[model samples]
Target: MEMSELTALLTREGLALLDETGSVESSADVARSVSRLRAAGHSPDLVSAVVGQARLRVKARPKFGEFADRMLFTRAGLEQATRLSVATMHAIRLRRAGITHVADLGCGIGGDSLAFAGAGLAVDAVDADEVTSAIAAYNLAPFPDASVRQGTAETSLPDEGAVWLDPARRTAGHSETTRTSAADWSPSLDWCFEVAQAHPAGIKLGPGLDRDLIPDDVEAQWVSADGSVVELVLWSGELARAGIRRSALVMQAGETHEITAAADADDEPVRPLGAYLHEPDGAVIRARLIGEVARMLEAGMVDEQIAYLTGDAALTSPFVQSFRVRETMPAHVKTINQALRAHGIGRLEIKKRGMDIDPAAFRKKLSLKGSAAATLILTRTTSGRVAILADRV
Candidate 1:
């Protein structure tokens, strides 16, 4: 939103109207609300901006929970902003490192800064965009210890006890951001690493960042929330573990699971598909800790390079979703179609790895017609491409 509209939104009338209107759940809902506001003689810009923010608040419920109502967000800022739960973890980590003050470099909308302040730390939050920095200031106003600055990180580095950096990975506006390569990341990774070396720091990065570029002495942690992989973070100095170097943090509901290894493990031996198929959690896979899960379940990889595992027995754990293998089928879509028809399978949940195929397009070609439902796993063995039909266990 433009700064002028934001200024209007902060006025007594605009805020009262925005609260009175509550959340706009959809585009049609926003349109209807806008029409009603215009009929009431509200300015067009005020109506548009407040309505847009209301819609964003509704969309942001999953990330910020009740706090979303009190927060302002840019479309791009919300996309890359850390969820409150995850940010709390970062704060706890910082506090444990004896950090009483934190410099949140590139603090988009001050999401992490909010968490740090709540954790009882004084914060200096910086954002390059003026409007974003202003919104961050408003959000952080409740925390007297937290302050925001509008400027580039290179120009406005906070001299403080510790630092947290979240480089902007997108090159476009919040509404339509384009993911750029690591080289294009703002407050570049090289610069972040340099900063980390000199300060007790943590840097947030994309989960898919190249492992080779990661520094040798920091703790690299990949975190996932509610089954979706989120950002990776590198911790250094006091924030870094003494010996641990890699970790995966899985957060679901009120439960949190974690796995760690000092270094990558050797690949498990490839074996034929077993009675059960296990798909490791995304966090585990991202951290290269699949072997740990395999060992826990007494399973082996279906292919030495594939993340899919096979076990003869059931596993009771959160690290992987186990499926009972119903049958093995040919990888050919036509043959699979016939097999599905014979098995009375009308519904299919498709999963693929180590294979080049679109699950949605292939599902359409099946012309599915049956009373039964099942999951289809398409992957490769050392031998060749294979299909394993299974049921969620």
Candidate 2:
């Protein structure tokens, strides 16, 4: 369809036009549709509606296809943006730390920039891709002073209060290459360090970013939502405390785990599993502060090799859940099926760790029935694969 037709359709439908044909050939069709809609005078509400609908439809199909749309992999020149949760957290941290001006490097779709601006901070948001920059401008249009520029961090950032760099980790022509090591990251630690030296800066990195490469002068933080670690935040300048890395678990309702590295100093101590076992948030996991989490709970590993931490006392750790182990077993497909059958199991809550088998497939194979319900955890300990029947503590 012609651009005018697409725009008119979007305006009439009050939704963004997502040409399936165009989306299939190149996901840029969505961006083109958005541009056409804009040129034809469609409102952001209408455009967002259409795009949101298309995204939902696309995501409902297959995981890989969903990734394509989400990552903007099919788009010729669009850069996918960070998730809202991560952006909001970053903004919160920046504001809390009293950062007033920010250079948002790789500001795709301007999610982080908008959050920063909304938090009353002056922001210079930059992207190398023209289309992405334009979209970011549109996204940030409501903020009167927020500037959206098009260029790489090396050329775009100005001397400011702090620099926020989220480098493109995915290589060109590949969608699954999500490595967070300094070696794999674009704009490199060298570039980030240069920016940091110029001004106090914060770099948004993958949760799995290598801890060893983290600069000694900077503070490395892992941030999680609920009990899952989502991203790593590296801070430079006065904010970086010596030998005191921080890990945070943030919940939407404002619960947080602000753990310092010093908590783990001296020999690692092991405590027995308590009344409750709390899983650390994903951010804590990425920060590799599981040992600290265990300490916080006064807990020890269920089996040394497993991520499961147990304690005799109930403690607050936002990285993991506090589950009451109701039962235990040597896990086997046949044995598990028999146990479920014996319990008259119908509904199964399956959880796994250190296991390669697909849960859905295992559930299907069991063909469970009856009214019994149980939480099944598949994990490896110092011993080996075992199943724990657990209840939320």
Candidate 3:
């Protein structure tokens, strides 16, 4: 939003009108609201700001929950913002470490700052973008201890308190942005590393970040929400847990589970296929702690080069999705399709690892005519490629 529009939206009249209009779900609602507000003789800037924010609030619900109703957002800021649940975990870590104040550097719309403030910690939130800083200030207004400022993270770093850095990994834009190399990130990764080394800090990064870039002194944690790997966070100094170099945090079904190790765990020896095949959560696979999970399930690697684990025991855990083996067949489409047809299977779920074929394209080539359903796992062993038919456990 422009400065003029933000100024207008901060007014009593604009806020009242926005609250009255409520959440906008579609372009039709936007048009109707615009027409009504225009007819009421509201300024075009105020109308645009209110309508735009109403739409954003709807999109923000999944991340912010009910708090989104009274909050403000910009498109890109909302997109990059951390989810409330995940941010709360970060806040908990700091609080547990005896940190009383947090400097949320590169705080986009104050997502993490909200969590920090809500946890009863003083928050100094900073963002480089002017409009986003203003929006963050508004969102954080309810917390007396939270403050938002517009400035580069380098200049705004607080002399006291733990720091939370989520450097801008994209080029600046309100609606659309282009990804940047780590070297080009605002408050460059090198600078972030130096600051982290000096203070109790947490650096939030993309889940796909290169392991080689991770500092040795920090604890690297991979977090997954539901089934998706969401982020990699590096905790430094007092925030870093002792003897824990790698950690996987899984948040699913309102429960959180963590597996940590001093370093990447060794891969289990590959063996023949077992009765059950387990697919580890992405966070587990990313943290390279599959060996730890393999021991828990009494499972062995389906292939040394792949992440799939297999065992005969009927076991399941939140760290992995288990599938009961039905049959094994040659990896050829004709052989699999005939087997599938013989089983009277019409619905199929395709899973793959260590294979080049596209599951979607492969599914199209099959003649699915029966009523039964099965999952097809396409993978390779030391011998050759094979297909495993299975059912979800």
Q: Give the number of the best model, judged by TM-score.
A: 3
Candidates sorted by TM-score, best first: 3, 1, 2
Q: Compared with the true structure, what per-residue lDDT tens digits does model 3 show for residues 1-393?
A: 888999999999989988998989999999999999999999999999999999999999999999999999999999999999999999999999999999999998999999999999999999999999999999999999999999999998789889999999999988889899998999899999999988899999999999999999999999999899999999999999999999999999889999999999998888889999999999999999999999999999988889999999999898999999999988999999899889999999999999999999999998898899999999986557999999999
TM-score of each predicted structure versus truth? 0.95, 0.75, 0.97
Q: After the best TM-score superposition of candidate 2, give how far the Cα of residue 372 lies from its true spot, in angstroms.
A: 2.8
**Which parts of model 2 have CA positions greater than 4 angstroms off?**
1-79, 172-185, 226-228, 241-243, 252-255, 263-278, 314-316
lDDT agreement with native, every candidate: 0.88, 0.65, 0.94
Q: Per-residue alpha-carbon lDDT of model 2 for 55-164, expressed as tens digits?
A: 43354233222333422212322224555556666778778778888899877667678778878999999987665676567557778879998888888767558789
The RMSD of every model to the true structure, in order and in angstroms, is 1.7, 6.9, 1.3
Worst 10 residues of 3 by lDDT: 379-388
- Which candidate should be chosen as best, given lDDT against the real structure? 3
Model 2 Cα displacement at 23 (Å)?
17
Global CA lDDT of candidate 1, please? 0.88
What TM-score quantifies how close candidate 1 is to the native fold? 0.95
Stretches of model 3 off by over 4 angstroms after superposition: none
